[model samples]
Target: MHQNTRQRLINNFPRSSAQHLPNTSNANGSSNLRRVGYIEYDMSRMLGESVKTFVYVGYVVEKSLESIVDKKKVAVKKIVCGSAEDCQKNLQEVKILLNCDEHENIVKYYKTETDQDFNVYIAMELCLGTLQQWMEGNIPTIQPENVNPVQLLKQTTKGVAYLHGKRDAIIHRDLKPDNILLKLVGGKVCVKIADFGISRVLPHERTSLTIKTYSGTRGWKSPEILNAHSSPPGNLRAHPRMTRATDIFSLGCVFYYVLSGGRHPFDQNGNSPNPELRDPNILRDRKNTKIEHFSPRIGGYIRLLEQMIDKAPQQRPSAAEILSSPLFWGHDKELNFLVHISNLMQENKSPVIQWCKNQIEEDHSNNEDEFLPGLELNNVGWMNRTCEALDFYFMYESPRTYDEFLTKDLIRAIRNMGTHYETLSPSVKASVGSLPGKFMAFWNNRFPFLVQTVWNVCKVLITDPDFDSVLMFYQTG
Candidate 1:
């Protein structure tokens, strides 16, 4: 052990637990001695494993002569270095963590310790799991109902922006979902960037450096890094000059995975026209591929991804640019409103009847032109969709009470259909004449309670003069 390490143990440790108890002369010429090694904890539970290390969840006692440590959990990363050269490289990673101050999105660093036997242990705040694991469990389709892609994209971009905006910008060479740690905060999940082992800090100047060592995970490396060796004979110096654009490409892949619910954006498996979905290392002269057959609903996000993973690195947007893009903020407002309707129905029963009615009126007032057709109801395509929603709600719901009918959005949709029907010319209205039996056959067959909800929604059409004639004929029949 070095002399400094020996002193550190002597100064920091309790006198009673020291392996070598130092003797000293007191003021009265009496001898005083101190022993060390009081702090103790077991690094037994294995949390995770990496290329050169094993992370264990453990706790340590501090400022106590007793060997008992509190039960608060901490992740202990044990890095095994066989040679001094390997040890120095590992220490550089620790220095980077130390330099980065507290950031909510970046993994929290606690402290570092080294043993005389050349084992290094770094303790950090514990997280539940990784973003990769979460994705594996919650698979999303093109029309995502359960997952919120907007929230995921916003949080991920925030982390990248912080890293790139630093004085000496840091590029996370391995920015896969697996490196993102997830923690539950106030019933919502948040992500933190972890595993900075292969990260690189760019110099203040934009000058390129020739890095011989390859870094990054498969399917996420940028085109420049993948085609580094394919440069022209005179351009040997261009092979390893990686820039911030590399990270942008990887981030694009991440966004694809989240938005597609776990499908690889570059995946050409199935009917997609892109070549192969495999790693870039295998294809030396690989052609640049584009995202194919993505859903039109997520087109905004897909457009941003296209710009991010562009073949030319210069064309890719910076992290800040991506954060400010319209794609990041764009989400279907109607879909969100439907989600709110679903939640309002599920959480309460008594107040939801009035709530649903108020929401429908508010939505119509806010988007009057959207629900109202230009001339007539039957002239627009939404007439069929409104009828479909009515049919679906009536067929699926087995509500015991009228207030519990699962037709909130559908009710609003049908009301818009009714309003449009009232505006048609008498000649046009006479062409399609039936009223009561046509729209409410399935609804009327329901139990008494269920029939009331549908009756309340259709009552609005009684104000129409032609509809009153049709209703009088139906009521007398």
Candidate 2:
């Protein structure tokens, strides 16, 4: 670590003093070193990113003598400073930790320890694992109790908001999923932002800062940072200029990663025709291509992501602006839930559709009406949700009609609902009937089962004199 940077870190804890503790250990290799308020333990081998800092898993004991002993698992980062660069990086992380208050979305920083070598050990609250590892293991799905990517992203945004709202706004140059760690909160996994090694603190009054030092992961780095270089033949490139918006771009990449189940938004994969984008390094191509292809599951959040990773920094919303976005406030849960269910339904239709029918049956009473109450589409919010769900179903599973996905029981349920078209609300009649034509028009082939069902409903509904508007929509829509 640089002398000045080390001094700044020391300044943050002026009253603190370090005491050398004996490295006494048991047969299992757990340490018995105890401080006034902390009990240090033997850490496991180093893990995490290949940076100068080393992170290990350990536990800390607090208030041992007070008879209120509490042992907490923690991630201890040991920085054996070998150069000025290492010092600055560690110091930067420590500074951000000191400046920010404890937030649920942000990793909790305990205290820093220095050995005789002046090496710094930063102790922090440990988590279950990194978001990257979690995603790799669990993957993305809309299972009822599974971890929702939407909720994880919300937690990440809140952490960023906390950083940006501080007196000295902190810019996390690297905001990839790897830097996001998770904790089981109230039986639900919550995301917490960590690893501020490359983060920078900007003056609160300053809207922008000219940072020539280029830092961040290759594929996840912002365009401005990559393009800031001025090439000189046979010489190393210059550092890039950066702003707070850099993090937003990287976040968009994270969002894309989560949405596509580990696929890069800009890179070519099974869906891409252009072979060039299939290369390992996609940072250069990301700015060149428009993100036209993504998982249809993420279609709802695509617009928000576009704004987040906009080429022009000024065009992207700030952390505070993102919090107020309608995307966060409205129908996201229901929409995301439906999107997940639809994804499963499209992938393996028969079982998922059967599961949906079973769930509807299990949840509702045998009142024999409104098996799927939301399908009535009386609520405008629910109408939009159902429309999108049906649209996604038809658009993705084209040529394979509902006959393959829907079981006999589900089809009977629809037919039973169709029998009472004359007694149905005008809105319900129009909404239910409109789905068939929309599906047929989109797929360019009328689905027989759906058509027959809606046709039967229309036959009964048309008898009502007030069904004129509903009849027109049912036939022409």
Candidate 3:
């Protein structure tokens, strides 16, 4: 909203803009998202310890129609890359983030730009330090050499909820303490979720792949995900199907570290009281014992965490289910207290959202679909066509037709999805419910052509978009 930021949005918009695509609409066609002017705020600042040309980024400033760098005032994401794959991966992550939009707690993206030398830069809010730093500090010193397990689980729940209910169910594949940034904003703890570049979308097909290389730190991979068959590990394995449960495993590792005062579950040098990690399955057998004996604040939460990091892909919890779990109930009062304070502050500031405030009087007079509540043509037909680059990703290879857009890779994704859905625990299946209605609908409709060779496709479901509801009031007038 600053002056320079305003100017940036105007200057940065792609020239000779294409016709705006229509979004899903109910009666009056109001669900469509309009392009807006915005500024790209300065999200870069030199880090004191980092030497990899890494800059602490600030959020993008999308005010009206521009991209401008802001002064080093607000927190942002740190942008770094080592290759072309990293560059492509960065943009892919951005596209996913754009679809996700904003949540009160999720880190924000104001503007993105490419450098003079062709390197891409993502500008966004930066956090002060990771949770690992804090745990290694006074919190560990004050206690009787023990950590507050309850507080740890509560914070994790708070963050996971923001990703789940708050921001369209994003799965943070690597949930270790080092990635959890703990900051002091206005004297209150403002936990900002970071490192989405390595973060894979579990149910959503995000994260581009080139080589079947191992990603994420060694200690964090799930048993199934860890390419351990070869010496030095991960040398000769077929690329594994990424599932929603992969993140659950990573979260378990995170929970283990947080509850145990920054000590890694897979300790290498054997410097702590804990036993050494021989294999990834150590988490599976030791989950209940460790939670019962070690943690104070997060004592009971570990059982819930075990459900997430299950050794089997089918055993883990989806991000959505984790939020609704009884284990996170203690976190409820804290979240509500904060939401109440937020509501009171907002009540003092403004009114409820009126997205179609500019609705025309005459436009309300013309709508044949007013009789139908949730039915409407999804002008967002481009969901499939627009993302043809990921054609095989939706229903990738196998018995599928070689000619169709949704290739073998995508068909595999669809297959993995059905397999995961059917095999998941009841709680997790309930959690995976109705997340990708439009995309699935688009994929399912394409099957006779796209997946003709493939048989036994999963059942499809698509929900009425909220955008359609907005159009109703205006079109029915």
Candidate 4:
């Protein structure tokens, strides 16, 4: 491990009973350490054998009691690296996950952990199950009355939002009946986003994050992605970079499938021109792919596809903007739930605020275990420098002044949260409630005077007159 990353792990390691405690201390005073092990194991661990250990739910990985006993509930993604591209894919995924973490309908990304070749994992929330299972088996069959247009709109938005990339082909390659999943907590349903390996980031402007080849299943490819018409002159080989429109095309297919009761929209009825529906380049046959055309009454549900499946990448609305569309107002159940949770968080101070005040006031000088994730999580120089301006205010100015700054920031966060909540719909809002307390605590202690500064930074970045698109996170389908 690099010295900087090792220290980051030590500083951010949580104090919880769920993690196993081992006798791992060394003579040196380092709070934590990573050892190089040479164990005698059979050839099975070499081939990346799939052994199903009872770990976090909705996960495809192995786990041991010692490592995960404490963080018992986190959903981790474990990928067995078998090729150079696989390793590079994991690294690129880690880079993107770390830098960009925004959006309401998208899954909350935590940290990516690398455990040599023996193991690799991406820990996130554990949701109920996939959408394919829900649509083909239970929900559509038993609860037809509960088919929610708004919730479907919002949930799919979240799926495409995560799949939103700097490059267009960075879409959900495996977008199908079975890939979508749902989990309910606190009496509200939330969309769970997953499957990173098959997915890649799409580039926005002409840049390096562009697609290298046409990957993913054949069924999900867009018209342009499926054909070689975009090939540059004098070159027989096409430019393989997938565009933003790739996902919108797949999204059109997914919605058509759901509306058709698991029927393929492209299936032929004797007179079909392209009976296979394998080539996405020809979409004229799709008018017959839908199971039943959306009526003016229900037509609204599928009508939005006119723009989403446009042949051009520039025509599709971004994931964040789509979440705010009027088409989602009445159909989705998840959107309604997010709206409620966001409103709840907007009132007064959040629970995390009280937790931080209690911790800072009571533990100011008290003795505690060395494993606490406070103090050096970020360098004191950097962490303190965030408040360099506030330092003068706190030392020379009154506490009342700092309190006012805090209140203003909290209010701003609440208002922003409201817009985000409305975009995400309620299902997403409910899921995010898990972290507000932690975020609030961190905001008050870490930033000290957040309301006054974060917006100042946001204004210069997000809304500046000279601003253009080079996103830390891309939220479009």
Candidate 5:
């Protein structure tokens, strides 16, 4: 840390004087010959009470042959456990934090120590504050707009994906906004997930675990978790299983809170003085899948949240799947995806083309629900009307059928957009430029089913065979 940076961090500490404590044991072997200057906070307003811990700002000082120097700054989490269970939980969090230190989005663990009173002290990288504090206007230095919610959500998803992909998969049972910490890196806001007290590490052979213990905050708990205790014992079918999807549900709520400017999807009026009254309503709404309406500004981003917070845990997308969503794609990436789909459609043997043919056949077989049956390509009136509604440039010669529209006309439009990018309408450019954020709503408004069908088909076909291999088509022609 620079001298100026060190001074700036010191200035942020409360007015109370620092208490110097000598380090007796170096259990982690991370540093040498050190004492910590622990910053004090008022116990009445301490934020770590819920987790049975006390958090403080602390500075590590190393003594050399010459002089003592302030080596590093860290957040010291002290847990005074009253029982064996509490001690085990504290150790679990410390172990998980140390294991996850390599990831940039996770808080870094420096070292751990114990005192004569059996209090566990864990020192980790100090961040500015929690995501809750930032959103609630507690952090005055950085504005909310400076931290792009989309990018923050992407980073958070990456961290969750990392945990799920581990050799022994980890499930963060308590993943709420308060557990996400924020810091400024090169004048840009970066998120760091913290406080894994209730996290569980799954066995190598298992993907999920069923536990009876109730964990996680009320408003953000998944439907399965909320129903865990309600179900009868030994009823495996009714009991909630802890899986990677559990984290995704909480993440969805956090995403909504971030995008909707602190409003929860299940509870619009989250500021109720009585959480007892508010929490049950939120839970009820979540169980019924009754989401509050998001602003039009969020556009199709809500689709991602809906899938994540699905009532059935099995229906929710995995952490890796969430990361692959078009919600995270940039303009260049979206254009590449569209171009790749267009290229695939040109080949008769292409899976994408075959998928479209299959869809047309299925729709035709079910005459009761035929989509735009007998629609002709050269129907200038219908084509113009549809194109105008979709904000698409009309073609002189259109496809003869709806299948042809998918196989030829749609592909031609995508190709033309890429080829004539310079001459396209500003709206068209913006729609493609912002990806699902703008394009999804733009097309969905005109052709809801058609747009969804094409997008889903292309999304799967473009990354064919292996759903894990996301955006592989972007690298191809």
Candidate 6:
């Protein structure tokens, strides 16, 4: 430890209290110190360190009749503030954590204390380790079976959504794997998003803010933030401003990292054989890179990531929009959506049906063979196919029209599955419920354009008062 840090620790805990605890030094050269407080931290067991803070492994200690017993373990983040502005910045993180601690996917905040020297000590729920450490193989106790990459992404997305949905929308300017912690909750691995030191909370009525200084890590940063500091004064507005969408881009990168088993999409060539040119090479690649490295097995998640990391900030989906994606939906939810769409297809007078038909016609006219090849228009119009059509489109290699899939394939699957769902075994139901990947695969392979097409139509329908109840059913049900 630095002399100043050691001196500060000694000053914070007086000599009288220090004598009660054991004094020891570890192989790594960190020495132990005793402190007097409701929560006691083992100064020797440092968890991590940043430029402004040091995190130590701590425990809630209480005195019993027999001896002193440690009740619960926690993490103590000691932030050193040199000036008033630095202290306020450190306090902002505590304030944000306190406000958002109710969420399961967010790190839980306990209590905070300050020393006479203006140093802030925050006690928070301790996690096994960081996602970065786990990804790098530093955490041996957590095996592959204990961690679910998709679940981790879903939980993190939920936390982000909660923050963005606050009255004063909070933008987590810095979101990277290092800031994401992992904990064992009820024998299963859970994700907890941490580190709000650089987060920004927008005022009511304000959606975005323009900051003079740059924030966020390179490679993980959205293109907007990367260019914010370099744009000319007159072109500032042209550059994307800081908003909740900024975190979406970083979340996409983190998702890529988790799925790829630690490789950064923008920095794939960062650690090449030529050591001297790595940094410059990564910088150049990020400047002009298109994401193309994700495994095809990820299915629709690839498409979702593409939308998230789009260069235009406004084009990216909101956190809530991301939660509605098929990537996060259960098989029942997906089947429900398909059945709902099938029912809408029966009502030819419905605006959703009319709009989808127009889009299908437009797509067919523009891309002919690519959109719906080998279809004989003289056979039957799409409006004629209703719930009465029992033919299965899944039996056929491909559908001749969008209505065929919606009315025939989708309806038949729902009927066949719904009728037998109760009779099926529990294991079979488990297999059936875990079908997001297969659902995405089916759509991506068969109807390549349907997902975006339907979403676009739904966006239009949401604004119509007549479709309010219909939209509510689709959203909530």
Most accurate candidate by TM-score: 5
Model 6 spans > 4 angstroms off: 1-31, 34-39, 60-71, 231-240, 268-297, 347-351, 358-459, 464-477
At residue 51, what lDDT does model 6 achieve?
83
**Candidate 6 per-residue C-alpha lDDT over 211-281 given as tens digits, one digit per residue, 9 for 90 to 100:** 54677665677767777667776765665578888899889878777876665556536233232342343
Residue range with the least summed lDDT across 10 consecutive positions in model 6? 385-394
- Give the lowest summed-lDDT range of ten residues in model 4: 35-44
Scored by lDDT, the top model is: 6
Q: After superposing candidate 5, which stretches have Cα over 4 Å from the reference?
A: 1-51, 65-69, 83-85, 231-239, 268-292, 295-297, 347-352, 357-411, 423-453, 459-477
**lDDT of all predictions, in order shown?**
0.53, 0.55, 0.43, 0.43, 0.62, 0.63
Deviation from native of the Cα of residue 342 in model 5, angstroms? 2.3
TM-score of each: 0.57, 0.61, 0.48, 0.48, 0.72, 0.70
Pairs in clash, predicted candidate 1:
15-35, 17-35, 17-36, 18-35, 18-36
Tens digits of per-residue lDDT, candidate 5, 278-386, equal 3565456542222234443254345567778777778888888777666666645555555655555564475556776566334322322222322322323234324
TM-score winner, 1 or 6:
6
Displacement of the residue 467 alpha carbon in candidate 4, Å = 27
lDDT digits (tens) for residues 1-477 of candidate 1: 354754464346221222322222231242321111221224445767877788776543344357543444567677887765666567666655654525677888765655544556666777877777777763232123444666766777788888888887788778888888777666566668877777788877864455555666777787676666466546667665787888888888788777665766566542342324545522442323332334433532344676787767788888887765434432232223233334434454544346546544343223223222231123232223333443343345323222322245444433333335565445434433334333332222221111222232333444555335324312210
Residue-pair clashes, model 4: 34
In terms of lDDT, the poorest run of 10 residues in model 5 is 367-376
Clashes of 2: 1
Task: Indicate the residue-level lDDT of 351 in model 3.
Answer: 25
Error of 6 at 382 (Å): 17
TM-score of 4: 0.48
Q: Each candidate: RMSD to true structure?
A: 16.9, 15.1, 24.8, 22.1, 8.9, 8.4
Clashes (N, CA, C under 3 Å) per candidate: 5, 1, 56, 34, 3, 0
